[model samples]
Target: MMKIAVIGTGYVGLSTGVCLAEIGHHVTCIDIDINKINLLQLGNSPIYEPGMEQLLTKNIENGKLLFSTTHKEGLQGVEVIILAVGTPQGENGAADLTILQQAAKDIADYLHNNPIIVIKSTVPVGTNDSIKEMLEDHCKKEILIVSNPEFLRQGSAIYDTMNPDRIIIGSYKKEASEKIQKMYSPLNAPVLITSVRSAEMIKYASNAFLANKISYINFIANLCEQVGANVDEVSMGIGKDKRIGNAFLQAGIGYGGSCFPKDVKALLHTSLQFGLNASLLEETIAINDSQQELLVVKALQRFGSLNEKKVALLGLAFKPETDDMREAPSIKIAKQLTKMGAEVAAYDPAAIDNAKKILGDIISYTQSIKDAIKNADAIFIVTEWKEIKNIELSSVLKEAKLPIIFDGRNCLNKTKIMECDSIEYYSIGRPAIIKK
Candidate 1:
């Protein structure tokens, strides 16, 4: 089994390290945050992900996983160092590589055994070359850098890591590429080897394309709403075509998460940096920014004003099963509702604590879906958590004073809403069921 060191114990690093250990590799995960590392040492995951903590505990018990706050201990005798640090979006719409660069410097100082460096973080094209140059200069030796971008989704990260659709390994040396390929041999997935620049481009290109599909479907959903055509049917009809596959076709308020928004903007920034006009990418971001406020616009159009109205927000996370609130649509929706003089009681199965950090005391937090919808004039289904999606219409109708529901994610069952004639139901790309 390969001995691996993974820097930055965020969602990607922690999940990757845990999964690698699960596959029988001895992994040490390093983070700068002592508190985070302390918690992880005790077999507790700092972040929320399904099946992550269990694997973490199991691996710790089996002597496969390790956690540390310093690079010196973590990088010792490691065969591979996986860089999974954050590349947050900067004020100029470019990815800020400050953390990644810092990690590289730390690794350079502490690394032994000439371990191969694998970059699993999303970066702009040519970033791997820059990182390689930086590391070689610091170490005064030729260092192997592999562009191995991660494609794991947030909520399902554990599963995605273990069962990836494909693995892309980009490197300058065949030895480095083959070693990295053999490391993932346990996964038995298809591996594509290319140049460092091409592998870097693949990550941004993939995220941008998925973001484009979400925005495109959102545009269609808007058109469908105007013409009374069901977007669900339209998505299914087009998805049946093998070429068009239906992955991101679900019409919703928009796509929001750590990856899509940052990667799309980063790609647009890169395109413009090269003196290329990327109008489609620009529009993709624009559409998503607008779509996040659609439910508010709908509420405004229906009520004319939101003065002192009590609105229940069904979910606060960007999507389901994770507590990541970065660029979450709920942030925009909550701000808009509060600015319009509405009282919002928000609920999410997992993200309430993280949401409170971003949202503050502006909106109330509820423990249950029932608590969120109590005595509300309107309810907005934001994240579509299983609890929110399976919420009894009878409970909403009984608890809510007006029984008005706006489904931002289109998670509610329309047939059930139709059966309950007293509740008003509105969803993305679907006909509103309003009772007189």
Candidate 2:
């Protein structure tokens, strides 16, 4: 088993460290936040990810995983260092490499020998090369920098990590790449050995393509609504073509997460830096931006105006099974409705605390969907939670003041919702239903 040190105990770091340990590797997760490290050391997960807490607790109990606040402690005698820190979007939409650079410097400062450094965070092109230079300047021995970008989704991070579709390792040294490959040999996934730049570009390109697919479907969903065609039917009909899969084809309030938004902007920034105009990415972002407003506009059309209207929001997190609210469309929708003088009441299974920080006193927080819809004029489905999708329309309409449902994620059943008296239903890429 490889001895690994994972810097930064955020989602990627914590998950990677624990999951690696579960696979029989010795892992040390380092974070500067003492409270976070303390919590993690006690087998407590700071983030709400499915199966993460159990895995962390199990690994810790088995002594396969450990947490520390000091990078020096974590990096000592570590054969492999995986940089999984945050690379948040900077002012100009480029990836701010501050955290990555600091991690590299720390690795350089504490290097006892030549260890293979792997970047598991999503970084822009050429970052691996810069990291190599930084490490070489600080270390007296040779250091191999490998680009091993992660492709794990938020909700299913552990499963995705263990059973990845492909593992791309970009490194100048074939031996370093092989060692990293052997570390993941149990995964049995296809390993792609390529140049560092290509591996870096792969992450951005993959996210951008997925974002584009969602935007394209949203565009088509809008057209379907206007032309009286059902988006669900269109999606299924088109998705059956084998080449076009049905993954991101669902019509919703656009795409939102840590990956899609930042990656798209960073790719655009990279293209501009390289003197290439990325019109496709620009349009992709444009469509996603408009989607949230489109939902708000539809609400306005139904209510004539949002002034004093109490709208109940079903979900706050970007997606179900994750507490990550970074760039969530729910926040944008809440702000837009509040700006228009609407009273918003929101509820989510796990993201309420985080949402409370961003939304402040602008939106009312409720403990349950029933509480959120109580005496509300309209109900807006923001995040597509399983509970939200299966909500009883009769119960919600009974409690609602106006009995209107605006589904941003198309969660409600059209026929069932239309059966209720004085109830109206609106959804993306579908005809609106006004009770006769």
Candidate 3:
């Protein structure tokens, strides 16, 4: 088994650490946050990924997984080091690689042997080569630098890592590629070996393309509304074609979360740096940024005077099964409602704590889905959580002062919502469902 050390216990690093250990490799996940390390040492996950905590507990018990806050202490005798640090978006649209550069220096300073250093973060092209040079400057001995960008989704990280569609191994050195491939050899997934530059471009391009699909469908959905057409039906029709396929085609509020928004912008800036005009991505970002304000516009049209009106904001996080709200539409929707003098009560399964840090006492946070919608004048379903999707509209009407819903995610079924005569429902890509 490859003794691996994964740095930065954020969403990607933590998931990779646990999945690597589960595959029979002895792995240690290190982070700078002492509080997070304390929690992980006690078998609790700082970030919420499905099936991570239980798997982390099992791996710790079996002596395959370990946690630490110090890189110097964590790298002793580790044959391979994976840098899974954050590449946050800088002020000018490029990905800030400050953390990644520091991680490379730390690995070089503490290395006991000539171990392979893998870049698991989604970095810009040529970053791996720069890391190799940085390491050589710090260490007397030569070290191998490999680019192995991760494609794990936030919610289904474990499943995606264990059963990846394809594993990308980008290395300049053949020996370095072989060593990294052996680390994930147990999974038996198809591994693609390419140049380091290609691998870096692959990560940025893959995410940028997915972001394009979302914005394209949303633009189409808006056009469908204008033409009295249904986007859901249109999406289904186009999805049947072999070329289009059916992924990232769901028409709703624009893309958010950690990867799509930032990566697409990063790719755009990278292209610009090379004097290339990336118009499609530039428009994609513009559309997504405007999409966040869509629900507020609709709400204002439906109710001109929102002063003293109670609006229930459902789903705080950008998506379901995770508590990350980096670019969630709910952020804008809640602030807009409050700006218009409307009372906002919000509920999310996992992101409430994080939301509180950003939202503060401006809006009231509720305990249950029913509580968020109850006693409210209007409802805005921003997230597609399973709990919110399965809620009874009749029960909502009985509890709420008014039975009006604006489904941003289109979570509620239109046909079923139409069965009730007292409810006024509005969703994406379809005509508003109103009571006679």
In order of appearance, the predictions have TM-scores of 0.99, 0.98, 0.98
Error of 3 at 369 (Å): 1.7
Q: Is candidate 1 or candidate 2 better by TM-score?
A: 1
Query: What is candidate 3's local distance difference test score?
Result: 0.90
lDDT of each residue in 271-323, candidate 1, tens digit only:
99999999999999999999999999999988999999999998888989899
What lDDT, from 0 to 1, does candidate 1 have?
Answer: 0.93
| Model 2 Cα shift for residue 358 (angstroms) | 0.8
Top candidate on TM-score is: 1
Off by over 4 Å in 1: none
Q: What shift in Å separates residue 434 of candidate 2 from its native position after superposition?
A: 2.7
Alpha-carbon local distance difference test for all models: 0.93, 0.90, 0.90
Query: Between 1 and 3, whose TM-score is larger?
Result: 1
The most accurate candidate by lDDT is 1
The candidate with the higher lDDT, 1 or 2, is 1
Evaluated against the true structure, the overall lDDT of model 2 is 0.90
Write out the backbone clash pairs for model 3. none
